[model samples]
Target: MAKTVNIEDAVSYFDTEVLHSGAWDEADDALRQKALNNAERILYRTYGKTYDIDDSSKWMPEEAVYEQALWMLRQDDAVQKTELGQVGVSVSGISVQMAGKPQYIAPEARRIIAEDGGSSPRSKWTVI
Candidate 1:
């Protein structure tokens, strides 16, 4: 579930909205993983009728998936801005999310990675 956020305080602060501030995202990675695991289970059992058991947890809007991928890629220290400009970070040095399924990765990540300048690849999008 791309709805996973690292911050708990933020989770409470926001409208429980998919897109929220980063402050609530302070939870440890282990905790985050546990939450995501639970989310998948919940989704599979709760919304099985809406989405196949295999796909319920897997279902995500393209924009959210793209945002998630971008977040993961930026976590790597290698990503950088083009010519130290305001433009988004470059994917040339960034790495993909760890042990993540292909569904979680979005086409937009590659698009942002390939951009040359102007907009911020990382700052523009959100978890929502």
Candidate 2:
């Protein structure tokens, strides 16, 4: 699922960020690839309406997608949530309702996308 950003590019992008936790660095090739694909999918779902996903000229920011992948790796529950696509998960009587909408988005990714004018309206508007 090679989208706009590749693993090598993500690695180089994170290298310059002082706040990077090195989790992406520790992840194996398979995990990294999965994370990148998942991140891209999430972004496309979240902002696809606002941005031209198929148009390279208007491709979403690569940094935003990279930040999303890194953020997903940092979360202990991210993998389970994304993999299962579950609204809530209970383990050993501990129940956790997964965050919704904007909450699922990484902060840096959100900021980058917002700055790039990728903010999407919750509802569509049509002029008659």
Candidate 3:
């Protein structure tokens, strides 16, 4: 199966060098590919396979590809950070303001997917 997005594309989209090293590292490449696969799966599950048709006449939009890649990188980063045990620890005497929440699929990505004309109708009525 053709990957909707690749590690290089993801690195470019994120404007970071972290993922670039994954291209040469075996373990890192696996993890990066897994993230990309998960992102593509989410898009297919949410919007249907037709949304990513790969025919010569019609191809997936560049914006959609970028959005999906961004979401994929976000998920990968969240997983790595969580695995490294970087989560905040709160104390009773000290107050701390939490930073931005981690998201699997960003709102902009969701909006793009929802607007792709692949979403099912909210209701179906039957009359006898």
Candidate 4:
């Protein structure tokens, strides 16, 4: 079964739990829906497959999904960054170092995923 997180829940999460830019409130229904959809896809692709479906916490947390959705709305290039997952870049003698991994998952969300045992199998060699 595909798990879906409601946008209203995410909105409420931001409204009460997180300090945010209020972009979710400003966005139209379609755009908010798109952001939520993208957030879900990223979370599932990164962590869902490894979850034990029978576990009580099988579904991704609402707060995590909300964080990802807000991040997507705030950072337009989030999808590309998540895809790249690269650390640093240098162009024409200009070097730039990213603060952390490029995956679009928010830090708090990542922590939640880890705590919930939602991480995929991986070895040290894996960059993402």
Q: Which is superior by TM-score, 2 or 4? A: 2
C-alpha lDDT of all candidate models, in order: 0.38, 0.80, 0.53, 0.70
Rank order by lDDT, top first?
2, 4, 3, 1
Candidate number achieving the greatest lDDT relative to the actual structure: 2
Give candidates' CA RMSD values in order.
Answer: 16.5, 3.8, 7.3, 5.7
Instruction: Let me know the TM-score candidate 3 reaches against the reference structure.
Output: 0.45
> What digit string (tens of lDDT, one per residue) describes model 1 on residues 1-128?
33433334334433354363352265465654554454444433433343343454544323332334234433433233222333344478974433322232234433432342212223345586
Candidate number that wins on lDDT, 1 or 3: 3
lDDT of 4 by residue, 14-63 (tens): 77887664888789978988988888777776775765334546667776
Listed in order, each prediction's TM-score against the native is 0.29, 0.74, 0.45, 0.66
Taking the tens digit of each residue's C-alpha lDDT, what string does model 2 give over 1-128? 85688988887777777365588989998999999999988888888777666888878999888888988888876555655676777889998776653256888898899899886636778999
**Model 1 RMSD vs true structure:** 16.5
Candidate 2 lDDT score at position 39 = 90
Q: What local lDDT does model 3 show for residue 56?
A: 35
Model number with the top TM-score: 2
Model 3 whole-model lDDT (C-alpha atoms)? 0.53
Q: How many residue pairs clash in all the candidates, one count each?
A: 8, 0, 0, 0
Model 2 scores worst on lDDT over the 10 consecutive residues at 77-86
Better of 1 and 4 by TM-score: 4
- In terms of lDDT, model 2 sits at 0.80
